[model samples]
Target chain A: MPIARGYAATDASKPLTPFTFERRNPNPDDVVIDIKFAGICHSDIHTVRNEWKNAVYPIVPGHEIAGIVSAVGSDVTKFKVGDRVGVGCFVDSCIGCAERDLDREQYMPGLAGTYNDFEADRKTRTQGGYSDSIVVREGYVMSIPDNLPLDASAPLLCAGITLYSPLRHWNAGPGKKVAIVGMGGLGHMGVKLGAAMGADITVLSQSLSKKEDGLKLGAKEYYATNDPETFTKLAGTFDLIICTVSAEIDWNAYLGLLKVDGSFVVVGAPENPIPVHAFSIIPGRKSISGSMIGSIKETQEMLDFCGEHNIVSEIEKINIQQVNEAYERVLKSDVRYRFVIDIASLAA
Target chain B: MPIARGYAATDASKPLTPFTFERRNPNPDDVVIDIKFAGICHSDIHTVRNEWKNAVYPIVPGHEIAGIVSAVGSDVTKFKVGDRVGVGCFVDSCIGCAERDLDREQYMPGLAGTYNDFEADRKTRTQGGYSDSIVVREGYVMSIPDNLPLDASAPLLCAGITLYSPLRHWNAGPGKKVAIVGMGGLGHMGVKLGAAMGADITVLSQSLSKKEDGLKLGAKEYYATNDPETFTKLAGTFDLIICTVSAEIDWNAYLGLLKVDGSFVVVGAPENPIPVHAFSIIPGRKSISGSMIGSIKETQEMLDFCGEHNIVSEIEKINIQQVNEAYERVLKSDVRYRFVIDIASLAA
Candidate 1:
């Protein structure tokens, strides 16, 4: 067994503290990653608070992982010692699930989560990258671009692909109009990607708090959805609308803003049900849909797309000890975009 | 002006009565159709009772018009005297307006309705095909194939296209699993067209009342949605579902029946909002959207497709005098499928 040290919340209402755990010894297909940075995502907070009832206790909640390969097993050919890498939401999956194509291995059917989850055997609890190091299968590990700093690149594992997968799937490109709802960590990536994809991008935020930032990120327009004019002015306008917020929204009203055969894709994970109206989808042939995180192949493609377009998330760096404080700030929407933990601080 | 005769409901509470009205003379681009068969859609009943308040009364509520081209204006090249013709939901749109494509004119903004509507001048109330004759633009009128009977083909104008557009748009074809959520008039058409398009069709009806009928009409399976086994047995199975009934349904429950990236297309007009859970769309990338009646171009294709497949609505033919009784029977879903009034009965 390999010992690892990380911060975790033992209870739903508690703050993070030091926790000791053991990782399995390197299998021939595994690579031990010295996690350089871990992003403090909203899901981390959700898992720590046990908002999802299935959350395991002593939960080491971190999924957005950015790191370097310190060691690789004999059979791991995808990465080598000193190679930069990142591990996203899941660390293992059924590579041959029928739903997946031959080129890409299907994930999440029996795949182990980075934290608070079990492997296929369901006995050993899988810890995550809030720790100083993580061991992942090479097939699940992806190469990080050289230009994107490790700290700033952590959120890309989760937020970046969450936005990119839907936009690309829906064909966001020249002559298309795209709207990014909410200006939080996920929304910001959608704005950057939508703009980089050559779409006429607009921001539909709660208010105009990030109007200037959105335009600076290449958005042509930004509107406060709280304002009545937003709905009237942009009615039947957008070809694609990507929602990144997790709170409950008026889905029917939001769907009303779509054009004929338009789609409103949700990356948001609200706790409640999404209420809809038949007329909302009927008149213009609009649709409301949801997307989860990307597959390994698409995640690599997203990173490549970002690297080619010079699109990187605006990240705020923090020490591992400040993670609980960062979570508090995130709840208040205080971070510039994302908070990435410097794992070196854990060692210190 | 030309005097036209039809049945009209003067008030919401009153039964339809024989009424005489006047229509403008055929314009340069108009084709005067001597209405032969007018299909009684559930919507017509809803409109006469003011269930759909948007209806403009002293309403002559008929849209599924199949007739002979009694006369054509000087510029009319598409239809001539003695040609079989049909007029669907909308008669005149902003003809040359920017909202319309010259090829696909129905998508045009400020689209005009077929009947129970105002003309471009916004004052003259337009009467529909329940009358002895109707004058529509050459662009809006479609040619009915000579092989199909007029009464059987009447519902294809609205009910057929209503299902066909969504099925085609969503790519319902070989290897696709489709479900039609009602076994009434529109749902039956969905089953037929979906089968014609080469998809495995399933009918999700309230009970097994129409099971054998559905199978005869090209459905591979018929299940009572009222049974709990139906949900459990077919969870996450469909690629496209055309909801053709006008009642409010469990949007979330229906959404669960879809596979990843699957869409639940709404053609039925519901009186209330359907509550949805974001979770349904989020986890599997599912969608819920609505569709209106098809464009004139697509309607022609639907007519041609039905002709090729030898498919037509199962209809009960009645004289104009029985239109009131047909309305009552439609409310009970007592008719086999559709009730098409023989327009020639109006002359007697």
Candidate 2:
């Protein structure tokens, strides 16, 4: 067993505090990573506060992890000591792996989550990426591009891939008119990746507050969705609308902007059910859909695409001690984009 | 003006009665068809009863018509007086007379429906195929293949194209598992077309009453949605589900059957709104979409494919006088598949 340190919330309402933990020795296909950076995902906040009712406390919540490989078991072919690697929302999946068929192995009856989920033995609790070190299967760990800085690449495991998966799956490319709703962590990445994929990108935000930032991220157009004229002007315009905001927008208003057979892909999963009118999808033969993060193969593709395109999140690096304050700022939509933690501060 | 004979529903609740009307004189780009057979679509029922609330009565409700061209304008190069031409759904679209992105054009804001809709001028209300003669622009008229008899090809216009559009759009082919919901006019066609497209087909009906016919139409599996075990045995099994039934099914239950990012395309639209939990779509990355009839290009493609495949809807051919009884039978789900009206019966 290896002693490790991380910031954890012992109770739902409490701020994170320094906690000690243990990591099991690496198996033949496992690699031990010394965590350098961890991204503060919205899901971490939700789980830490028990907002989603699945938080098991003394929870060290972080899934977007980037680090240096410190050790590898004999059979670990993908990584060697000193290599940079990253872990995303999941750590271990079904043994069958059942490569890349939506609900087949991982998320269906035979899946595992990064934190608060039982390991393959169904007895060991799987600790997440916020810790100083983690032992993960080599197949679950990805090679982080050398050109991409570790801190900047942390959120790619979550925010970057969440947007990338849908855009790629929906065929966003040259001549495709794509819209990204909201301009926060996920939205900004959507704009950047969409542009990188050669799509004509548009940003639809609450006000024009993020208009300048949107254009800087390669958006061809920006509009305030709050304006009534926005709906009128953009009616039947977008071929695909990727919504990344967690809160509910007026869905009918969004549905009105879809062209014939257009899709509204929801990455913004709110706790409440979305009250959707069937009529919204009827007239123009539109679609309402939702997408989760990418598969292991797709994540690699996203990483390669990012490496080639020089794309990374506009991250605000914070010390481990500022995590609680950062959470409040994140809730208020005050962060520039993502807040990544410098994991060394956990030792202090 | 050419004095034409047809059937019109004078009021919302009354059965359609024999009536006399006038079609416009053939324009330079027009072809006049001597209507032979008209297939009854669910939309025809909706229009005659004003159930969609947008229907204009004394409406002539028909869009699937197969006939011989009786007259052609001097500049109409596509069709001659004796050619077999068929008219379906929308006869005129905003991006008129062009096949480039015709699906986009079909639902364009100002696109006109074949019947019970105001024409391009916004003054003349266009009648439809349930008549003795129809003068249509050459662009909207398709050539029916010689192998597919006119009686059988009538339903091919509406029912055939509706299923073909979604099946092809969703990539239903060899190695793909496709499910057709319901066994009515559209559903039967879906099964035959999906099977002919080289996909493994399944039928989800209310009961096993249509099981034999479903198998004969190319279904590899037949299950009743009402049976509790149907979901358990086939959960996460299908790649594409073309929902031909308009009434709401258990969305999450059906969603559970999709194999990650799989699509359920709704061809039959229900009147009421469906309550969908965002979590249903989010977790599996599944989609629920609606499709209207196909474009003229795809309709021709569908007819050609049907002609080569020797595919047609199982129909009960009736004189125009039996349309009232046919509607009652359709409402009861008594018709085997579709009802085709012999237009010459109107002159009796």
lDDT of every model, 2 decimals = 0.87, 0.87
Q: Summarize candidate 2's per-residue lDDT along B1-348 as a digit string, tens digits.
A: 898888999889899998789888789989999999999998899888988788777788899899999888889998898998799988777664333455555556676788998766788888987899988889889999888889889999999999998899889999999999898999999999999999999999999999999999999999999998999999888999988887877877887888877887777877666666777888778888877788788899999999899998899999999999999999899998999999988878
lDDT of 1 by residue, A94-207 (tens): 767765563233223565777888865578788888998888888889999988778888899999999998999899999999999999899999999989999999999999
What digit string (tens of lDDT, one per residue) describes model 1 on residues B245-344? 8776777888889977789888887888876677788877888888878888889999999889988899999999998988889989999899999988
TM-score per candidate for chain A alone: 0.97, 0.97
Q: Which stretches of candidate 1 lie over 4 Å from their true place?
A: A102-108, B96-99, B102-104
Instruction: Kindly give the number of clashing pairs for every candidate.
Output: 5, 1
Taking all chains together, each candidate's TM-score versus the true structure is: 0.97, 0.94
lDDT of 1 at B71: 88
Model 2's chain B yields a TM-score of: 0.97
Candidate 1 docking classification? medium
Q: Which portions of model 2 show Cα errors greater than 4 Å?
A: A95-97, A100-109, A275-279, A282-285, B95-104
DockQ of 2: 0.56
Lowest lDDT block of 10, candidate 1 chain A = A100-109
Least accurate 10 contiguous residues by lDDT in model 1 chain B:
B97-106
